[model samples]
Target: MKKLIFFLLLLLAGFNLMAQQDGGTYRAQLPEITMDSTSSLHIISPEPIRYVDISSHAVAGDLPEENVLRLKWVPDSTGNLSSGADNLGVVTVIGQTFIAQYQLLSAAATPGSKLAASYDILPQHIRPLHLPVEISTPQLRSHALSLLARRNPSAIRTAKQYGISAELNHVYTLGDLILLDITYHNSTNLGYDIDELRFKIEDKKITKATNVQSVEIRPIWQLYPIGSFKRSYRNIYVLKKATFPASKILSVELSEKQISGRTIILKIKYRDILEADNF
Candidate 1:
């Protein structure tokens, strides 16, 4: 009977050891960062951070820009910082287009490595598994402007009203985003004070007067600021990936401020989106 009990205990011990080894495989392999009780470490990210996961033993928070995280080690009951992997904690920082994991240890507890005040999360350190997030807003605008600079071989779509012309020069697709190169020309001498640039999916033919339904879609990013422009104005706008049937059309509406008398609307068909070029 005693032998049977000892065998059962040995089997449970082996199972626990195997579980610990399996779990350790998924831990961060990078060398642990040292944090001392005297100063904090500033970790900068490439883009705006969306989430941060840190250990309870350390206190961490984002700055005003939300792209930098300041982390500091907490002192234990003995008035000393924690040391080693078991005593310290792990930090996982997630941004729009990047992710990094760090193991933090106390400088006072570990004497080998030097104390660094700040760390930059570079592109090479980004985790490969989580690459589906969207790029920064500035990058999207820059890409759109680059497309605008090039000449377009595709047919141009335009809408003209009150000596103001709105043209759709090109459409490009990236992942789940749609980039559009649009231009406006003011033939009249007066400057056009822009009020609002609206995008909507509406019916091609508004037959019923009582039930006119349209879905307003805002751009995820705009290349230019919304204000007055003289002569000619060229810019880019980005919207989320969407689909509409033949019965509906994507409308780009530009209206003048205050008076609201001068307005131009450009219609984009579903086929145009389907035949968009990949950037």
Candidate 2:
């Protein structure tokens, strides 16, 4: 019995030793992007497009802290985050509003090297509520100069400022149309496609037909392309002037899609409502 017990203990010890020697740090998957062997920018997401078996892969979840998963800054190459092939890209994979970018600077991009092998791979931003809407640019521009300004931004309002900057430009109320001009600037070097855009009112306690029939831009609008670094978009809505009271809240809700993770609601104060020609 002693001899059998000793043999079983030796067997377990050998298995444990093998397990320690078997797995080292993960050999991270190489990014599809390639830069000037010197340096380049990238954008990625760890959310797999296809189902991944986490048991076998060393993904961002398996990694501790932000060490191996995040990008490393190479200080010797460039002065800013763009240089040194070392300054890694910032990863902000927003499902609703943004698709941030990342970077890969290769000291000398060798397939097996550490620097060139890593980059960001983001999942496709999903949006469910897409409205069927189109704009007539000719008519839109024609009405711009003559239209009565209901509300124009005195100072730029910043909606979301991390990876993307959304600014409110102008708001005009024509005879039967409301024109909204918004500029979205992408600060990240990577590109993200705007999945879905929706326009609606948040008034839930309304019991009157007057408020319902007031301003009419609902359930249909788009904000140019979310992919562009700097895009100025216009939402020409058919709207009528309701009550230009001393103050009011127009919930201008704009977002990526179903995900409420990033939503912007601009409560417009119609101080300019008094500036209308009718007044």
- In angstroms, how far off is 129's CA in candidate 1? 2.3
Q: Where in model 1 is the C-alpha error above 4 Å?
A: 1-43, 56-60, 63-91, 102-119, 131-146, 153-155, 187-195, 207-210, 222-228, 256-262
Cα displacement (Å) at residue 197, model 2: 3.2
65-113 per-residue lDDT for model 1 (tens digits): 6688887655442264445434457788887766688776655554434
Best-fitting candidate, scored by TM-score: 1
Best by lDDT: 1
Q: Distance (Å) between predicted and true CA of 131, model 2?
A: 27
- Candidate 2 Cα outliers beyond 4 Å, as residue runs: 1-138, 144-156, 203-216, 219-240, 244-248, 257-261, 273-279
Looking at model 2, residue 129 earns an lDDT score of 22
RMSD over all Cα atoms, model 1: 7.5
lDDT of 2: 0.41
TM-score of each: 0.62, 0.33
Q: Residues 69-166, candidate 2: write the lDDT tens digits.
A: 33332344234333334423223333222232332233333443443444544443322223322333334545553332436545344566446655
